[model samples]
Target: MTMCPQCGSTFLQPLRCEAKGSDVLLVELRCSECQTWTKAPHTRADMKELDRQQAEFRATIVDGYERSVAESMEALATCFGHALELDLVTADDFRPRTASA
Candidate 1:
């Protein structure tokens, strides 16, 4: 049981927890009597699992971003191909702009 740091009340209610590795937990607690929030430390397992999960999440995000970028490039290429087929814009018009020194 956790006690409220402010009022010394034993009415601490757990709000949420953030796991840092497997050994430490950042537990958010709310005191029912004082209505204040406090962070408490709790024990857990080692950090290997936590690290793995974080890496997996990061990889998933990167993969999604790369896929989106590839799709956008493909769409642009298709549009350019259609424009060229219809003679809407000539390939010579796609020259790189030179910056004025």
Candidate 2:
């Protein structure tokens, strides 16, 4: 994570935006010690940038399924082709698991 150029404090709250489609955003960060507020950008060249800022700040996990998209090109295409046929049923047709008790 990049440090704040203003306060020289390492405790920075980084944020992100997706609307720009290139650079994610760090809206505002209040320094823990100096109380300085700074703005930063955490970008992703792949995903579409988000316009509205969200406080939920959920982290995106790039699992084996995701990594293959970038690091391995052929594997991603193969997975996508196979996944298209996977069955997706609604709640009415769903089956619940039995209790072990």
Q: lDDT: which candidate is best?
A: 1
In order of listing, the candidates' clash counts read 3, 8
- Residue runs of model 2 more than 4 Å from their true location after superposition: 15-19, 44-101
Q: What is the C-alpha RMSD of each candidate to the true structure, in Å?
A: 10.5, 13.6
Backbone clash pairs for candidate 1 read 22-44, 22-45, 22-46
Task: Give candidate 1 regions above 4 Å deviation.
Answer: 1-45, 98-101
Pairs in steric clash, model 2? 15-25, 17-25, 18-49, 18-50, 19-49, 19-50, 21-49, 24-43
lDDT of 1 by residue, 1-101 (tens): 34577998755666788986667888787888989998766665323343454577679989999999999999999999998889899656978988999
Which 10-residue window of candidate 2 scores lowest in summed lDDT? 46-55
Q: In candidate 2, what are the lDDT values of residues 24-47, reduced to their tens digit?
A: 543555666677776555555321
What is candidate 2's TM-score against the reference?
0.32
lDDT (0 to 1) per candidate: 0.74, 0.50
